[model samples]
Target: MISTEYVVSEQPFTVRRTVKWGQCDPAGVVYTVVFAEYVISTAELFYGCLFGQGPQQAKDKYQFGTPTRGLTFDFRKSLRPDQQFDTEVRVGRIGTSTYQLLMHARDMEGDTVFTACLTPICIVRGQRESIPIPEYFKEKLKAHQTSDAP
Candidate 1:
């Protein structure tokens, strides 16, 4: 299992989720696709905390949206229905128009069950063209950067 103590120690933005029956495969482990959805949802919550606004609000107010450029995850342990875990999201890297978000989900015992790296690009809402990250948003993301992510 991946050690997540350092990541959690900093108290990064987190979201707790319980694996639901519908999210599991016949073998009772969480379906792989569900993990991606969890990451996306957690990222939304992370952005909400960082910007004081959710995804929709950011688009409406700033005319910019963060769309996933790429995503990758490693499943360290299986999650069964009813299992509760907390996903912690931290800034990994901030680029001109893209930022890398790292996330790890730990079980009640604090063992990492899954880890993900997601690249999201800031884009002009209507044109969907990449743009430099807003200065204020960049500052907030930098504040959450951690060097201990796995």
Candidate 2:
């Protein structure tokens, strides 16, 4: 008999994305604002990968929330419709209640398309109050932290 299973990859989390026509403007270039959505979506997937389940549910079960503290992007190559890229996610600075997710998007030719840093603070879920990073969550992030991460 054959079985199937899913495991969290030891390497950094990565997602492949293709630019669809709908994601472009009349000029056929990806809209500037849409890149934020791509970064956020990738972060959610990274969290889900760590927990072995959906990210929101895992956050809810832990009674904590990760709300964005800051988001910054550095655009390199402009991406047009039909262009494919890959985003690699890495854990960055982790503080008492805040952590950073650094994402790098690269084109098929190995050129950087964009880079983003998403900083989210841990809070008591639904309470609007900051909280320390949960032990298990911290452990998972540490496992995938970047070499320069603190």
Q: Which candidate is the best by lDDT?
A: 2
* Candidate 1 stretches greater than 4 Å from native: 1-10, 148-150
Off by over 4 Å in 2: 1-10
- TM-scores across all candidates? 0.88, 0.91
Assess each prediction's global lDDT (C-alpha) against the native. Answer: 0.82, 0.86
| Model 2: number of backbone collisions | 0
lDDT of 1: 0.82
**lDDT value, residue 118 of candidate 1:** 97
lDDT of 2 by residue, 1-150 (tens): 321112234376888787878888999999999899888888888988899999999999999999998999999999898788888889998899998999888898999999999999999999899999999999999888898864
Candidate 1 lDDT by residue in tens digits, 30-136: 88998888898888777767767666887669888888999998889999988889888789888899989998888999999988999999999877799999998
